[model samples]
Target: MAYGYTGWGWPTGLRNGMGDAGLALGIIALVLFIAFPLAMILGVLALIFGGIGHARARRGEAGNRGQALAGMICGGVGLVLATLVLVLVVSTGDEEPNGRMDEGGYSATSVR
Candidate 1:
């Protein structure tokens, strides 16, 4: 009956909110893994929030530990996949269109 106070005394919804946000961000990250930068950012955020939520849950401060765990797992997987995709793109981008580089470090077609 007081400002910022719920029936359960102090509001514990903050932890659960973090868990929910983490889960949503993790799922979005997974869905957008091809956008490596965005996925990486989202994955990192998800991991952080999920970790916090999970820790709070473990301490009985919140109630959504399972959701937090799922978020952490998905975020980790997304982060790894995004890194792999980024590495693959960068590695492949260094090659010449014809699959060969000239002595001058330029593609043979670009030498002219």
Candidate 2:
């Protein structure tokens, strides 16, 4: 029930909280899941926070270990997916001269 190093307090509770945050962060950092940057931010937070959480959990933090693990996983996945989506979006595209997709389709102006 202590915030910081209060000499002698419970690490379990703190760790548990940290773990939960990590998990939540991982989940957030996804596509159509949380927000754009929010997810990314949270995901990173989860990883860092989760690592600390689990470490604390090892020091007797109730459920921080699990949270940390979850955070790492989620963050990884989120990063991958986010990167993929970004790449796809960025790489996918420039407009054709006719203002249409370059899938080989043409307008009547071409026919004339």
Candidate 3:
């Protein structure tokens, strides 16, 4: 009997592992982007992991290059959205003397 050449492949699972993780993190980040605080954290993580995954894919290690790239893009978009939300909240919150104004012309603190 002749043995087949099923020993090992050029690329290993390690590469795909990071790429898959990056893709998942990016998706989660995008989904939670509405939550500004969490978005920042998740976005950063996605970006980092996605960058690593992209590198691996570029080096012919991982097969999911598209996923890695998408993850990176999502992370960046999430970060931008989070920053915008934060800015809007801060700007609106500071518009009034107190925290915010109720339906009437009264300040939030005064109303309470």
Query: What lDDT does the true structure give each of the candidates?
Result: 0.88, 0.70, 0.81
Deviation from native of the Cα of residue 4 in model 2, angstroms: 32
Q: Comparing candidate 2 with candidate 3, which one achieves the higher TM-score?
A: 3
In candidate 1, which residue pairs get closer than 3 Å at backbone N, Cα or C atoms, i.e. clash?
Answer: none
lDDT of 2 by residue, 1-112 (tens): 4565657655444437777887887877854332445655666777887787788788774665776888878877887676666666566666565766675576767786
**Residue 107 of candidate 3: its Cα lDDT?**
62
Estimate the Cα RMSD of every predicted model relative to the unseen true structure.
5.9, 8.0, 6.0
lDDT of 3 by residue, 7-88 (tens): 6668544456676777787788788877999988888988998898889889987778888889899888888888889898
Candidate 1 TM-score, true structure as reference? 0.76
The C-alpha TM-scores of every prediction are 0.76, 0.61, 0.69
Better of 1 and 3 by lDDT: 1
Instruction: Name the lDDT value of residue 103 in candidate 2.
Output: 51
lDDT of 1 by residue, 56-100 (tens): 899888889999989999999999999999999988875677986
Question: Which structure among the candidates has the greatest TM-score?
Answer: 1
By summed lDDT, the worst window of 10 consecutive residues in model 1 runs over: 5-14
Off by over 4 Å in 3: 1-15, 95-112
